[model samples]
Target: MGTTDVVLTDTSPYGSRMVTVEYEGASSVAYLRGAGGGIHGAVWLANHGQAPSSVDLDRLGRGQAPVMPRAHTRIPEGTPPFTSAELEVLWFEEGDGAALYRNGDLLAVIPGWADLERGMPGYARDAVGESPFAWSLEEALEGLAPRIAKARSYWEWRHGDGAWRSFQQFAMSHLDTRVGPPGRYWDIGGETLPTVGITERPLDEYTVLSTVGMSCQRMPTVEQYIDRPDAYARVELAVATRHEPAEAAQLFLWLARYPWHSITWLGHGHTARWYGDAAGFPLGRSYAGVLMLDTVPGLPDMSGFAFGGDEVRWLWLIPLTDHELQIAAERGHDSLGLSLPGRIP
Candidate 1:
């Protein structure tokens, strides 16, 4: 059996436009109302069985990117516009493997270490008649300064950082060869990071929020936790920093690769498993106990340690060891005494 859903019907100065969609098993069609409400722009969803929602149809009609259902939730089909700070943060987290696009054109696919060693020097030489390693950081910066200046205006408006300064700082910090062996290719950093790679893709707050809710409900397994740590971390950071959840989920869907982890259902008598070494302490379960005076010379009477809470659950890892637990405790001090979810303090 099949079903037809009129996802959206809109009338504008141009004409009356309605998006009628149908889904049956692995087949779907989006029929557009053309001139005089005639059928046009019929597209097929050959690989996806999910029916298009009203929001998706509306976005398509409005010439905006539509969201598609993937795995356990829906995600944006195209790249969304990203601020300079967001781009910088993403690049910092992803390193050279960050995927960048502009105006639906693939701009730069930042090469990883192996790729750099094998092909970067030749590519740079062919592009500019010299090995990228030949140029010092200053020379690279000088060459890229003009491009940086041009892109700086957009970022300055988006983030209040001085024109090109933020980009310059990021380049200097991460591209420095002196920091490690990888500094040999600092020139590559100058070439790509300064350019505005993001397009004017709209990100809706509500959509992102809904996606985040879905992601939380579809929790990853331990194997998935290990494989897509960056994706998980990015989403967690986004939620922590209050970015739209849908955007984070979209990013995760775009970037995450599999051997997905098995789902560990949370219930009574069920152990929560995660990544890292198994420590004696339970992850995400808060504990209150006095720090002995022998361990710490001076401490407040009421001061106690809590292992983990709702806010810090993402920090908990698989096979959490004692030393790692201590380090996490030290780092996660701010999360102490925070109430767990569904529990009264």
Candidate 2:
């Protein structure tokens, strides 16, 4: 039997007023629910099951001009305060490519291969121009629901534990895991990514906390700023410390999404000064920022890393003092190496 699932939900004004009814195999059904109640909408899909055009639901949510689908069915008289249950019942009882109604007025219609109309409300149609029709429920949800699909795919992929195994295997070749599973594995929330885990491992006398998921998706900021970014597109951050695992892991929290959050790429010899008060730093008041390195001179063999067909660069997070941060900022990160002999900590 086919299954039905709600793929996306939003509560933003007009954005929340649309709805979509999609086929579920031969016998099931699915839908998209807009947060606010509405009595008007347009239908964009047909019985042929061809994929809809891509829509940037993120942009649409900001009230940008709507991207039109190839086809649409308008509700001339609009709809009544009908429940989804009523729509489902109307769906099964009606035939394919159906235009449905209640009380002798058009409510909605499942478009068909030949049920094409270049019509939409006047205001939206004029603004978008020759775009066929106004935004439809399916198109919007299709764009916005990648996170849901990604979540489902991630759970499926997790069955093999390939990512974890790969990371652990790579890490164990250089460090030690006999200390047991990470004392803490930080999971990023609300992201479509398959759990980006910040796992803490033991490296000899020091603690090495590294990010597992940051490399799962290529960093866009990295692509925009770097040359041949694919080689550096994916990165995993590591911090070696003699301090508490919790305190050292704090560096990951700040620098984990640094490239994307700050709209830049991080690479070997890159320096990032702490943005907050000195007392709030992970290392202590003495350190003001970090210098990223591909491999620490005194650390493990953390080089030549690869995962999922992409070169995964390991950025070693080394804390720097205020004076060192200033030197790196003034002359360049490379200058710090010459200016301070024992700066690595």
Candidate 3:
């Protein structure tokens, strides 16, 4: 609410293992990651449980280059190769233990998401790389063939709608033609990438992000139908978030506003802030980290990207029913989480 600095310990109170916090004026968020992780059912959101200092609004607005005094990962190496406008998915490629860079300049690299569905997140670019060097939507589609095929199989099994809603206008949106890098059908199986008939016109253009060395080429954004018709179909589920009553309420309000609604919130400084509806901002967050969905984002980060610090962003598909949503929220259950016993088995 206001600016005030406080230091709090969460080691025993929540019985958590590792914890971290980011303070913005009077607000501070914290959560556990080492043990159960942030299984709060909101993707990779932030929590200020530890301790944070309140700062003056104007001073905070000066837009300080976030100085994470003590961080876990390293920054990417080299000078940025392109502007934030040049490409889509491009950046360092190493592991969680390495650093992150933008156009080659060292940026922040927090602890890698330990819980990606099939990959542990090797060194990746800034989620959204520039254009030109980055793959065109067409090129990306080709590289993503295997991933898409795999995802389609799973989707077809669960949501066997004739229209293949699982892909859900994925290709059409590319037709918008206003978002990221242009196309070049270099390896297109059918049409030349350019003639792929894709466009980026309708997209806010600002709300797109890319993924490097991931299961796919990019992680896009948007917020819509909670999970989907059955709530059982989930393409992505936030296992948890890191926030307390106040912040959680704020987040909840944004989530339960019905469909086709929107809101405007801060972008955690990683990217610019863009206005989005509160009703079902697809990309969810927690104090542990923010799980940005390529398919949908609750509030598509202005830069069309977000980062999860302590929390690990796991990708999967689970359409949540209202009953299920409430149940998970009430029990601290993750919408698409892997049960410990199940994981072990």
Which candidate tops TM-score? 2
lDDT tens per residue, model 1, 43-77 = 33222434244234554465432333332122213
Which candidate, 1 or 2, would have the higher TM-score against the true structure? 2
Q: What C-alpha root-mean-square deviation, in Å, does candidate 1 show against the real structure?
A: 24.0
lDDT of 2 by residue, 1-345 (tens): 234333222221112222344333211112222233422333322222222345536644753333333243233222223334444212111011223333443333332121123444211211122233333433434432443344335435544558556655564444343234455666653332223567777656777677766665555435335667568867888877777878777777777755443324678888888889999998777889888888666665555656545788888887888898888878987776542224435
Q: Tens digits of per-residue lDDT for model 3 on 131-245?
A: 1111112223443344334433533443345433323244324323324442221111121101111111112322122211111111211112223212211111111222221
Question: For model 1, what is the alpha-carbon lDDT of residue 100?
Answer: 28
Q: Whole-model Cα lDDT per candidate?
A: 0.25, 0.50, 0.25
Query: Sorted on lDDT, highest at the top, how do the candidates line up?
Result: 2, 1, 3
How accurate locally is residue 267 in candidate 2, as Cα lDDT from 0 to 100? 82
Ranking by TM-score: 2, 3, 1
Error of 1 at 73 (Å): 50
Residue 95 alpha-carbon offset, candidate 3, angstroms = 26
| Predicted structure with the largest lDDT when compared to the true one | 2
Displacement of residue 124 (Cα, Å) in model 2 is 18
TM-score (all chains, Cα) for each model: 0.17, 0.50, 0.18
- Give per-candidate clash totals: 13, 0, 91
Error of 2 at 65 (Å): 6.7
